[model samples]
Target: MNNQHKPLQNGLHVVVVGAGIGGLACAIACRRANPPLPVTVVERAPEILTIGAGIHIPPNACRVVSSLGLLDKLKQAGGYQVKGFTLRRYQNGNVLVEKPMGMRMKTEYGAEWLAIHRGDYQGVLLEAAREAGADILTNAEVIGIAEGIGESFGKHMVVLKDGKSLVADVVVGADGLWSGVRELVLGRSFPPVETGDLAYRGTFTREHLKSFKNERIDQLMEAENVQVWLGPGRHAVFYPLRNKTEYNLVLLVGDDLPEGVRTSQGSLEEMAANFEGWDPILNTIISCLKSALKWKLLHFKELDQWTKGVIALLGDASHPTLPYQGQGAAMAVEDGAILALLLSRLQNQGISDVPDQRNQQLSDLLLLYQDLRKRRTEVNVAGAVDTRHYYHLSDGDEQICRDKELASLPDSAWQGPCSFNWGDAEYQKSLLGFDGLADAERTFDEWSRKKSRQANI
Candidate 1:
């Protein structure tokens, strides 16, 4: 065994398992910190493969990635701007509402929403991590993790299936929803629980969509927008991708949820059948699919503790969000950015310290990450859940009521938060500040001192 932290070079030696978009992005983000850290990404699969379908990265996430200097690479790997999203009735394709993206979002939030293939995004992130000096190892499955002892003991030692072991100061579980590291940290198997909804996803070439270029489909294909077709117990979304060369389709069905489907894989046929009476374009998209992967929507209700000892969970491992708001991966990306930032701050405090001081620093850093993220993640998670309910509303009087509520906004109202009179610039600046770690430490110290003084009093 490499008994010393010598090769670790006085910097952090991190082991990030999974190598998915979240894992790879975390590695890349860590490398982008003010002072770069050495990172190792371990994946069970021999090699990464593109699977499933497209993913929508909202403005909030795009902004984080931009901060990491990956805009060019992101675009290169199938990143495309979405003009907006339109809500429609599947029967006659009547437009109920339209949400414009891109410039409108950029103007409002200082970033643009991007849509790209899941595999494509993962490829970009992995490549970026490699270029940034992150060591990525494939087919290195971590079967178990045990805590270490003493200062510079590197927190946890991961044992692989092949009997190989890796010790690291930080062991980040970016391994998605069914994370082994999470199971270890939580001391139990907290598998993902279904959210009573399943999704069908597929992608179509522009050529396949040529005949369907009416106003609704045209807006869907030409406009970088997400077009939703709502129906009874189901909803479908179509959006342009990769400069309009392809169109992404997703169908969310509420009833008849499959018993044993992981959120990652659901029956596309069931998803399609739920939308049987919907728009012809949707039906066409369904027919074009050789097979639709199943996606059982899952949410993280528990797993309150995101860290234990020196091991922590990032992205979906810590908090898995439903896909309703299309910000699942966006949230994960944000988690990566925030965690990397906090870890960087910790490393800045000098790695060569006493055991007690090191533990205190580590705890302070983690508490800060949780404090800054918990509320925001909870907000996004609630939004995702609410959005899912909104999309799956059964068509009828209730559906009409929901639609009216959404479209009730008057024309006088601004299209986005940007047009609102709120002080968005100042808000953005405040959010951009990187003082969470300091705040956490001060809060802890103040609380500790206060408790002591109160006892004396």
Candidate 2:
């Protein structure tokens, strides 16, 4: 694992579209995880703006970040480490479920759940990628993709808005929900389908919290913890951030696309309207909010194939999960890290020993990466969908059942395997070894070898 001396394809070039969280993380992970490879990131947007209100970085994702050597940088970026998650009744402040989060996760899983401003988090990854020898080009829209035209591997002729063309050995479509690269590969006009839920996301200052008299509300805004209020068909999370100076508010409501939510316009008035039935404290908090944006939560129906030829999708481009599980960005980060690892290894294996035979190795490696990703992301997607209904439990019996299930969990279950031991090198090794990928490839390889033997016979 001495990255500097590790062999890599001498001049392998990789072009990544979209410099969002996943793209940037992919670049950094590829550079730092394995041997260094030439990586270029093309972002269609001129400047990276903080569009997301807030995102939860679970312990597993945090482990990957720590493994990538981003803990200190994240801390410096004003990311808040969460202590625990408290589930409470929607109207009254009665604790329903309390799960230890930060230090507990670290002790059990060897990582902490970190919550950070999206902009700062993206900046941290982008800066790291740039410093790690990645050529980051902003305002470069990829309008066309030319696959395997001249080279055996393939070339992505990225036509920028300025009519400039760039080529690379591989093109990664981390472009996100409305990915142009996905369209080029999938061969369909697929769009992000709306989930009939609207998200009112905002960041509130301490001054704005004066209207909330609930002690639990005060605790949520001031303490280093995550609090979620669950109701019928709706839920809201209030958590402290920016060193407790500000509170991040996320109100998930089942409503049509409100006019105020779409353009990122409108005052706190529109935000309050969505919470009519919610507690007065919530309405008061929304009324005092200085800024807010409404996001139409769109969940993509699963695609049969995430890749074809040289172009492949990443993050939301591959699998878009609803926000219920709070693992959207986390899953994206994991995807980036694992893909980088596989490609880097393939690049190394090809350069020193098999230069002339590199294409097959690279192709096989990409397929392996896809195989490694598919089912795990599918599981998360299913869990996210399922949790949406679970959290928004409308039926009284259903809510009672869920409560019973939660309560029935033995204390030993809670204490069992809270987090992963990321410090162990063996644990890292396991992540690289796609369990199902290996099994499937093994089974297929055995069949192929058997068929060849029979032919010889």
Candidate 3:
């Protein structure tokens, strides 16, 4: 669909304040809309850099990736399919629970789950967005936003830090956790609440595994399984990336970083100390790591609203989901997929040329987006919190019960209730099987009709 579609509709210009995965996805989605809207992404950095370790393109997010015609591209870029998941005891490498996801995720949830490096994931989206004709401007920092000023009601002013301004019909706040756009929308500074956890994250090449000459590590990599090592007050996640040629590891522990320091070079000795007497395989993997970076995890309380006038928030700006569930990036991608659907359909809403009516319609669309999105994101946040609690369980009856529940999960993916919502069919159906674009198209029409009836009343 790149460069082959008709020229953009040119009715409304969209300015996206961030060029991260969520923002770039938004740009691609808007460009793909029928009679597509024009999008210009304003990025603060001098250049877009590939950062982070691995990200999961779960079943729900796979819907969006497939829609953008990038599924094959993702696979080509080292997004390997995850075959299964294992929860192991940290004291010794004993598997407590195991579940299958490879073919089963596609069979049950309509799409396969992908574990890809963050760089590869963002690279594909960024390329497609540019090919789809999204104007991307880096080193452009947004400083302020003004709307309904200077004899113009159709345009909003996005004031950049360098005394330049861009005009747009809508401004998207896809800026990340430390989002300046978020503060702008709320008219006050809001900070992310610390989760009191810091992730010691590392990624290693396939050669590193081979250098170990350890059969256990080699077999694990070949299996392409997602493994979690559970211990008291801590947990570590390990998954294959880059077509199973690379490995990503994240160890979550109580934060000990200096105040106000969000990230630092992690000490390997300290990292080893945190996992004393743990699984030798885990320890061996740790020793293989060349370096580790410590990142403090933080989140935001749910907001009452996601939009202020023509400005709307998406991704981390509004949600700031914790990484416990691996849903943070997926939710952001969903936000872009759904929000673009509504905005692209804006031209078809059949509003008169009256500026007030048009503005109100835009506001209504954003509000409806907020209503549809709020509950779902809140549910995800709770799910992550639940998993975190269970994953970091101290040795006790509850922990034993949790392990038992995980071990006894049914043969079918969507089956009877389990203590683990992540694996429970009923719970996961609502999470993994959701189709955001379809929901937006269906809900927006119904919303518009209800609004029309109310206005007549």
lDDT tens per residue, model 1, 262-360: 644445575567767777766766665656566677766856788877777877888888776776787677777777866776687455456555665
Q: How do these models rank on TM-score, best leading? A: 3, 1, 2
Error of 1 at 173 (Å): 0.7
- Candidate 2, superposed: residue stretches over 4 Å from native: 1-9, 148-154, 210-216, 258-270, 351-360, 407-457
What is candidate 2's lDDT per residue for 1-457, written digit by digit as tens? 1111111245567788999888988888777845687888989888767555567777767877877789889988778788877776776646776766667666665567788888778888988998898888888888887543433333346666777767666678999988988898789888877777777777867766755566745755666877777788888887866777777888887756653344445456766766676666666666756665667787687878877665678899989988776678887888787777667655554443343344445555566667767877887787677667777887488787666555543464463331222112243323222333234345445644664597599
Candidate 2 achieves a global lDDT of 0.70
For each of the candidates, give the backbone clash count: 7, 3, 0
lDDT of 3 by residue, 199-276 (tens): 888788889888889899888878788899999889989988877677899999999888778999977898888999
Cα RMSD, model 1:
4.8
Give each model's whole-structure lDDT.
Answer: 0.71, 0.70, 0.85
- The TM-score obtained by model 2 is 0.84
Which parts of model 1 have CA positions greater than 4 angstroms off? 2-7, 149-155, 211-219, 255-258, 263-272, 415-457
